[model samples]
Target: MANQVVSLSGETTQPSRADVVIIGGGIMGVSIAYHLASAGVRGVVVIERAALGSGSSAKPLGGVRATFSDPANVALGKRSLDAYKRFGEEFGADIGLRQVGYLFLCRSEAEVLDCEASVAVQNSFGSNSRMISGAEAARINPFLDPEVLLAASFSPQDGYAEPSRAVAAYAAAAQAAGVRFLTGTEVLAVETAAGSIRSVTTNRGTIRTDSVICAAGAWSRHVGQMVGVELPVTPVRRQIGMTRQQPQPYPEVPFTLDLSTTMYFHNYGNGMLLGISNQQAPGFGRDFSFEWLGEFNAAARICAPSLAEPDLEFGWAGLYENTPDHNALIGASDEVSGFFYATGFSGHGFLQGPAVGELVRDLYLGRQGFMDVSTFSVTRFHNDDETLVREVHII
Candidate 1:
């Protein structure tokens, strides 16, 4: 055991040297570690300030979907979805994956048109998503009132999984592959020389490495600043609630989301899991509040008028590593040699972790990645608005 961090095993003696040091022990970090080690890259180490998977990656019910307005995001999400389907076989970890599907409810003509275009984009990428009528949407989730919906989009391959379980699974497999975990080790500085990563100085110890990957989740901005890289990631709080089980089991339904209200729900235990983006939610908060419940109730009454809000006895808050356009930032840094990052996924990090890990690994090894991620580079923010990647179908 080494540096134990919150419900995690103690770490071994801190390493003084490594081939690569990844900041943050969340999904992206663990996934990159596992993928790199599995690819025969040795001497990889991951540093986390707190317990692994204790960040946004700890969100219990994480939705996984290939449904997106942008084709690149669709590719990333779809590839990761396929990887997650085989996680049990490859990583020997059951992530409680359920492909109950995702249904996006549109309430306005503009929303319906946008959803239709999004579905078209998804279908162009072989996602198998399609536009469905309000009646068909009702059949999938009886809780919704069809009369209020203009139209909807459905993706059968989209669903939810246990985020913490997936993170643990990847961390376990990575450790088994000889990847070191420096839990509770806060990164103080990313030392560089002649515009290249030399080592990382941490609270516990310094690890000399030629390469560094910043996957520090919501705190990625600070990590980037330490290396003179502008990561442009802002932390925004998002919350979720679980209802007390009911007397009778509710019928299983797809993870249903109302685009207009940014409210969503899915089956959880014998009741339901509810979540809604707080428009007035300030950035960077640690505690969950009942303040958002009023907004949640207002949206609930409109989206699912028949369903009563169950005794909301369970809930938690987590941050979203948001970027200006709500698209992920994943690429190697030209300013700092041997520096790579995959952050600012907004709310899509967990679903895209597997694909992003492989991309970063290829970039590290100087191999051509499966997809052209030049569009995701941090350098894009420096150029015109047209160069930046924007995702319209985000929560």
Candidate 2:
């Protein structure tokens, strides 16, 4: 179906109808809009509660990698990385995509084996990831404290990008492809009748649409509640801290992940960007805490001594729309027809946003996506299927 969204002439006038109404102006929503438009779907309207890319997509440490424990995630990573590589030429935007690679430091024999196993899976998917000794790891990233490391997995194809810029690129491309964007428009409620999406009521006005894709990121649960669907998605807070630019220059190295402590760091400008995962008491708290700084510093001292400096120049927090299994909920919802989801990516959402958009576009248009998306369906939780693909290499 070629859906065309009628462009709004003025700020007060809302788009009365659209083929597809996508909520959220972040990377996921914008990327989906772009893909759908590029695929010849017209009348695609993206509703953003705020300006584009201002949500969780803006707060990431900007790490993009294919070094995942799950094959599904690895495949998605590979596809997204491919897109990021050509993003500059394709989008006419420099997303600062640097393929400096990703180095994961393991501290124990068991962790070493786990790293080896993940690398094996990653390599099978053409990731070309390999295990390196502590000496080699230090050589790859000289800032690492080599004495405490057992081994590390390095994938040269993986790296980071300017996430906000990437979001802008997708949004611009979508706009140019005839996708209408409704910035500052809040989806008040998604109205349905006869078990199918009828229209979406927004703060501005009503938008009649056949399909509604909830790409609302951290606010997806609340959005799902509008249709009486209980999405198993929660917003977990994650924080990142940056050090003051050093007077002495540090070598630009690969983004390093300390597996044992869940602490990771990489070169950002002349300083370093670092963060850690707090599994306990994960909630909707987006406030940066000094309490966590102490823990992050301790981990940094052990893993990367150079980043152990007490003076954290600045820090911020963002929420990850996480699911129980830490995998994304892609495809249409089983409960409501025409209601689709491309959210709940845990922390990997920003990295996988583009590929996911393309995948969703494929499924929506009744075409085979780049990969099998059966593993990411929303019905898996409904079918009482307990054997979910649990991602091990998350930080």
Count of backbone collisions within predicted model 2: 5
Task: Please name the candidate that would achieve the greatest TM-score relative to the true structure.
Answer: 1
Q: How many angstroms is residue 30 displaced in model 1 relative to the true structure, after the best TM-score fit?
A: 0.3
Q: Supply candidate 2's per-residue lDDT for 64.
A: 85
For model 2, how does the per-residue alpha-carbon lDDT over 339-382 read when each residue is reduced to its tens digit?
Answer: 88899988888789889999989878988988998888877777
| Clash list (residue pairs), candidate 1 | 1-11, 1-12, 2-10, 2-11, 2-12, 3-11
List model 1 lDDT by residue over 267-381, tens digit each: 8868888888766454788687777777778887887875545578678788999888888999999999989999999999999999999999899889998899988888888
Every candidate's lDDT:
0.87, 0.83
Whole-model lDDT for model 1 versus the true structure? 0.87
Q: After superposition, how far is residue 144 of candidate 2 from its true place, in Å?
A: 1.6
| Residue 185 error, candidate 2, Å | 1.3
Model 1 residue 363 distance off true place after TM-score fit, in angstroms: 0.8
